[model samples]
Target: MYVAVKGGEKAIDNAHAWLAEERRGDTDVDELSIAQIREQLSLAVNRVMAEGSLYDPDLAALAIKQARGDLIEAIFLIRAYRTTLPRFGYSNPVDTGTMRCDRRISATFKDAPGGQVLGPTFDYTHRLLDFKLAADGDAPHAPVAAPRQEDTPHITEFLKGEDIIQDEVFSDDTPGDLTREPMAFPSNRPLRLQSLTRGDEGFVLGMAYSTQRGYARNHAFVGELRIGKVSVEMDIPELGFAIDIGEVELTECETVNQFQGSKTEPPQFTRGYGLVFGQSERKSIAMALVDRALRWEELGEDNLGAPAQDEEFVLSHADNIQATGFLEHIKLPHYVDFLSELELVRKLRREAEARMAPKEAAE
Candidate 1:
């Protein structure tokens, strides 16, 4: 009766079959199409795009369906799919100044030039359950208006006019992608922002909240938050020109933080910047807060031993995919390591017991 189990291959096959069946769900009912997920579960699709660093809604939707609606799994699918695709070239830095914004608001000011358009938000909705949505439900239609062609000016840029906000020195430097290249220490703004954007929303939120709770308490005022679509262009090196590849939705947040002026510098306000791949305002805002906290050194502020101020700590552990994969991988076979430890403990116990027996007999 001491026979060892030997169904690893069969077990794996059965698991796969079960997963496929679960994903499909209810053979009598129509299979949930990728289009259905994309249109119906758009917020989930957005989360996948934001975290996955890919903007294909359809593919994200398919990933959601295949993942049994697990948002993180959907993001992983998109990320894996994205890694296999060929890259042509980099696009010019997106001018948020000239962005065609669908939604834009500034917290620093009561009113701004571009004007606040509340566009598509669940902010004001009560948490009461809408019972109708328990099943497939029809949504109400809203009046559509022609898209505005006028260029949108950033709220931060307006503050720059009054010297109220620090004007970021723009450079033609092309920052290295963290995904393509291994993340190196002393990361630049672009790399830091990139990591924060794809970072887990809840983790970032907690870290940001920590700053407000007396940890690296840099008084932060939300300068602006914008959600909109922007064209992504890739340069064709062979053709010597850039072509419009596609467009993506982005959430951008800029936070105004207190800055103590240096010897040669004037007393001016500092900024924390955040930008993400989709309409993820919460992530963007959290990212901005944490971004400012991480800049304590550059701003010549004392490190208050805050977790948010520790760049090595925060940036290293920010990615959920990396964290989850490493943490969960330990669930697999480690019997060999366990056996070694077990043997050591048993040997040590026997040696200690044998040594004590002679002393006890003498006593």
Candidate 2:
């Protein structure tokens, strides 16, 4: 991260001071509160948390403010800060089936179990900007209703009843954590899911779109998409049981993909799943597509040589922190490397000219 520049430490200090001034902008305007960003610009906060691999919204909001609304920079700050924290223990796996869903929908079936609850979404709204928001007016609170008592069954359950889709087999084995262990290739589904969940939203989105463009097509239907609060549990050694440590907002997506069965199995649909921190519908959907794309071999489908199918490529390039580190490093002066390349090119051109001169004179 060293920049080749004159005036060293004092110059860097002054530059930071200038940056702080720029971040504050006008003196007349009131400073933005962390709570405002957490509540109002919640989507941005969610994105930062998802990419940063941390669940603290207040911290995410603070990072967003400190980074001056640059989400990637905020994520970098959060990640760097997270490295200093002591790890007490890992939380047990969350149960999405019992989620207190705020939003839920399915594209495959018109009316699936628990019905379509279009909680807070901009899907039906006009795309044009409303001048009302500019006038410091907030929308009036809408009427509320009691949450449904009936359990919301997943769309896959119905499909599973008919034996038309592959069943989700739960394994007793503990899933691997990429951060805890050195990431090695030929990874399992859990490790891949972990990478994809925290992967760059734009990168994952592009990979998903590529699959739709017939580059390793896995015709997928949105089986179910739900966003809600799920309890985070941790096993207590003394108690000899798991306890709910906290709750986190999560977005879960399950895609029903077309899978022609192999010799050992029956002709039925396959599944692609995405479960991520916060209400990130786009990220979750993109994750599901890429997840399915990566499962080509396991599902007995031939790899169409797509970018999403390459586990190492997807896993390596998916991380925004790592990606930005590599990308932003080029901003620092490459004086020696550039000068060396310049010299090589000049020497090769001179040699070519000398050979051409002899040829021209002979001619």
Candidate 3:
């Protein structure tokens, strides 16, 4: 019997309660502290912050704990909270040229103006797990370096000197926030980068990998990859000028892509940029490759009908929260639709059986 079920509110409430209980298993055992998660499980928090488009590490860490270690769910929490925040102002772009970098490296040149500092990378670490860490072992301190205030230069500037790199003109005009506004066709560089930074890391990585696998093989060299803190400045109308609001940690990657110069310009290396919220090199690198692939049209290259070149496809499917939520939502009740399909199938079968029986009798 087909019966109408009308307990949507109760079902939702029950689901939420179950989720809360699941999030806090064995209540007698000590609940995970946000600080503990933030300090110990910092990488998870970092991913959340990077994907969430928020900079607060503490909030990201808290969200991680509350979401029961689901990075995407933690990101969703941070994103939702970010919407309620009242933005006082925007920061004047901190010149990366003036950044006090913690880690900076260039694959293009063996040595650049800012010497390559491979600070705190797991690149050379052994894959074997340390059993000691399972018991929450304390980390050791490294020898402290002398504090110095020195401005770091971008590797691209060196190419600029030789006129080998494409000219990058900075505009004093402000860029719109993609999250605040509905994305339109032919997005500007700012919007495109914003969408990519908050995009699904795996999706972006796969799209980038596709380009490498001959979908649209645009040779890319890591012009520069830097991770560090930068001060955010904002203009205060009453103060008549911009002031430093705060500092944020960011992972920025810039790739020099092999692009043939257009008819209007001389041959020079073009740039694909990726800047994310925290220490996420892989995401940033993937973002750079996808960024370059998306620029095929602007670079006067053939579209080649590649998925990477399709802006709508890449941008629409890049957010995991949106994609997963829509995908998982199918788990919700759909008995009415299923019943209708079942009835149609039965009717079709009965008609076929009647036709066959009459033909047999006639024979």
Q: What is the TM-score of each candidate against the true structure?
A: 0.91, 0.95, 0.91
Q: Which 10-residue span in candidate 2 carries the lowest summed lDDT?
A: 1-10
For candidate 2, write residues 1-363 as lDDT tens digits: 343667578988999999999999998999999999999999999999999999999999999999999999999999999889998799877878898888999999987879999989888999999888889867789778876986677888899888899888987788898888978999989999999999999999999999999888899999999999989999999999999989999999999998777756678898899988999999999999999999888877777788889999899899999999999889777777888889999999999999899999999
Q: How do all the candidates rank in terms of lDDT, highest first?
A: 2, 3, 1
- lDDT (C-alpha, whole model) for all candidates: 0.84, 0.91, 0.85
Q: Which pairs clash (backbone N, Cα, C closer than 3 Å) in model 3?
A: 91-233
The global Cα lDDT (0 to 1) of model 3 is: 0.85
Residue 60, model 2: Cα distance from true site in angstroms: 0.5
C-alpha lDDT of residue 271 in model 2: 89
TM-score top scorer: 2
Q: Which runs in model 3 stand beyond 4 Å of their true positions?
A: 1-5, 8-15, 27-29, 146-148, 262-265, 359-363
Query: Model 2 has how many clashing residue pairs?
Result: 0
Candidate number of the best lDDT? 2
